[model samples]
Target: MAQNKLAPIETSFSKLMGVQYPIIAAPMFLVSNEDLVVAASEAGGVGTFPSLNYRPPEKFKEALTNIKSRTKKPIGVNIIVNKSNTRQEGDLKIALDAGVELFITSLGNPKSVIQDAHKNGAKVVCDVTNLEFAKKVQDLGADGVIAVGAGAGGHAGPISPLVLIPWLKSELQIPIIAAGGISHGGQIAACLALGASAVSVGTRFIASKEAGVDIAYKQAVVSSTPEDIVMTTRVSGTPAAVINTDYVKKLGTDLPWLLKSLKDNPMTKKYVVPLIHLMGMKALEKSATNPSWKTVWSAGQSVGLVDDILETAEIYRRLVNEYHEAKQSLP
Candidate 1:
């Protein structure tokens, strides 16, 4: 583990979360799976997966069980509150039954989620893009808030981390976890210095070996630079940062094309080139070899910093090393 010379990370998140590191794997939609979550937890960081990743309730329970059996460390489950495809009550029930340590809810009002999570003795962390929502969640009794500012992977905020974290700290009294174009430890240190309790990373983890994405997607992340990313509003009605793939480029002018892409590959299994043009469901009917070979994967602007496909443990170690060194360099 890398030594942290930045401000002492002695907050509720670090204390009760009980992980050696103060980082949390941003719960990616289909890319974060049981294996990925488990690997990250064991590596000393909180690993998260979206509850909607599992189609049926039974499959969701099974995934929870597998993750628990694989690692004893704390694990987080993300719930998309405003998403159309989710069965919120049922998914929350399953997560509580499975004994998850943290519940990160986004895209909707988090009051109900906080109540349910508190009932189950689990912590509730809500994703907020602005101080208004941050105050709402804090007043409603959220344990923590994930500040999804500019450069964030999925649905993101227009605000910069330099502005958002400090603003939220002034308005709210709860723990704040900063998210966005944070690819290296220096960014993590910067977040802490700006009053964040911890850091939430998505794109960086997506490049790790434990991430359940395809090789092509991994390559896109490795090969990309900050200039290759674009902020688009076509995915789910919110501004989302994604790799400027041809598919996304087409989405700039065509809705039918995007819908066809989703219906074709509902799960978005990987960022392979073949998957880029192939429909997900149609490809499932075909062989994996032919499908994965051709997909253009999605990643954030931070993908430009990824140089290799490393194990989650190695990534965690590198982050700690960088964080410690960055902290030292600060003073």
Candidate 2:
């Protein structure tokens, strides 16, 4: 193992979260699991897994136990706060009861999540796309906000981190974890210099050895570039960055307004909308778990920077060294 000789990057975020490094492995929907989360935490950076990764509440608790048994490092759980997840509250309770100290909320207003997490002595970070939402989450008592900028994978925002990070910093007092388009250490350094407390990375970790994805999926990330990434709304009625596979291309960038309207209708939102979203998620899951990459494959523009599959620890070490080098290069 390469020795990480760089000075540690610490901020209020790291101190509050109890992590040695300011980097965090973003909690991907299906790609992040116990192994990935544990590996990341053990590597000195925090790791997070989506709550929906486990089906029942008991299973989620079991996974948390498994991670705790492996390492004493801090681990977080990502919860979708939207109505789409019927078991959101139950899942949150399970994570809290299992002693998770960090919670990352996505998709909807995190006011309730913030209240509940704080009540249980846990910190809540909400994902935001713009300044308005950032302030809203801050007002709701979020410990931090993850700025999901453009070129990120899976339901990304339209702004760049270069613009979003400083903007949020100027407007909000809470810590900002810049997400999207960050793969290399140079990018991480840039985000930190822009006043972000930390950086949230997802796509780069998809190619890590501990990722819960198939070999083909990892190789796709290694072989892909930014040009291969496309933003399409056909996937879940929301724009998300994904690899431009043949299957994805067939779906096109836009669905007909009539079909979109039907999917978005309030009357059918409970059933039809979820069904459509599930179909897209299932396709991506099949491609990730199976041996083939012919189905939907999600990736960020940062895929271009991922050229090989390495262990999570090695990835962290490389980031540390690169961050040091980049910092030294600046005048």
Candidate 3:
């Protein structure tokens, strides 16, 4: 594949991923499907899908095949390394066998995956929320580290990018893709100036036309404010930003009570347990009525800046223009 080049960002991220932009769409759970991945790739940005999104290994392979058939641009698959899921090795094998161009690992030692990816001529990118994790991933031979700073949608770093980037830049030699709280081109330029080679965006992309999120969820992303964000691990045992919906407020007032109520609720056994595979759909449906939007609709504080739901192409154009403008305005 020919290297697609960009000037606003100097790192070989675009070349490395064969995309025209350095933006990698965060591997949003449930929201990252073949359509979204194809759209983002077509728009010059890399799109990523969480491996677990496809429950069955065969389904994961099907997704890879579908994405490959859709676009020539680079696309990535995220192998989550959390305690809840240990399908990293199996997923990596599937992705590599499918000729996956890029691999992004989160929550685990990427050395094993990096080794295989490099052996297969694939690039490896790891997501890090703090300086320690950033240094850790870089040391593991990852091609780059995704600096997931504060305001990131899912499991995120609480520190500011202004502080994390310079710290990582001073210590790490690999390319750093700054993430979190980044929505506009100006923020992207700021991250680049601060030593980030590129940027990764999640919440902002969730509201895009290419995103696979429900319409009500998209609307929540578009109309949300920074203050409307609440970070909690009550839902998934990892800190994540979500809208301050009724469920959030309820959890705020009494999480234990809510959990107990859920355990006691008849719906838990009937719909939640029996129909576990449809949880994503049920979550989206409940989010519309859950009042807290927090039960399932996850976004970031950057939602305040995502006023309009545009096509992926328009989003890329806006980001590129803002990046140039910010660079020109720099003293």
Clashing residue pairs in candidate 2 (N, C-alpha, C atoms within 3 angstroms): none
lDDT for each residue of candidate 3 in 1-331, tens digit (9 for 90 to 100): 1123435354678777766789988888777888888888887888888997787888999999999988987889998665345577888899999888889888667788889999999999898877777777777789998888888887778889999888888998988899999989999988988988889988888888877767778888999899998886555434667788777777662235554465458766333322332343355446634434355678888998999988776777778877888888988
Scored against the true structure, residue 135 in model 3 reaches a CA lDDT of: 77
69-117 in candidate 2: lDDT tens per residue? Answer: 9989888999988888788989888888888888999988788889988
* Cα deviation of 71, candidate 1, in Å: 1.2
Worst 10 residues of 1 by lDDT: 281-290
Local lDDT at 172 for model 1: 86
Better of 1 and 2 by TM-score: 2
Candidate with more favorable, higher lDDT: 1 or 3: 3
Q: TM-scores for all candidates?
A: 0.85, 0.96, 0.86
Best by lDDT: 2
Relative to the true structure, candidate 2 reaches a TM of 0.96
The lDDT for every candidate, in the order shown, is 0.77, 0.87, 0.78
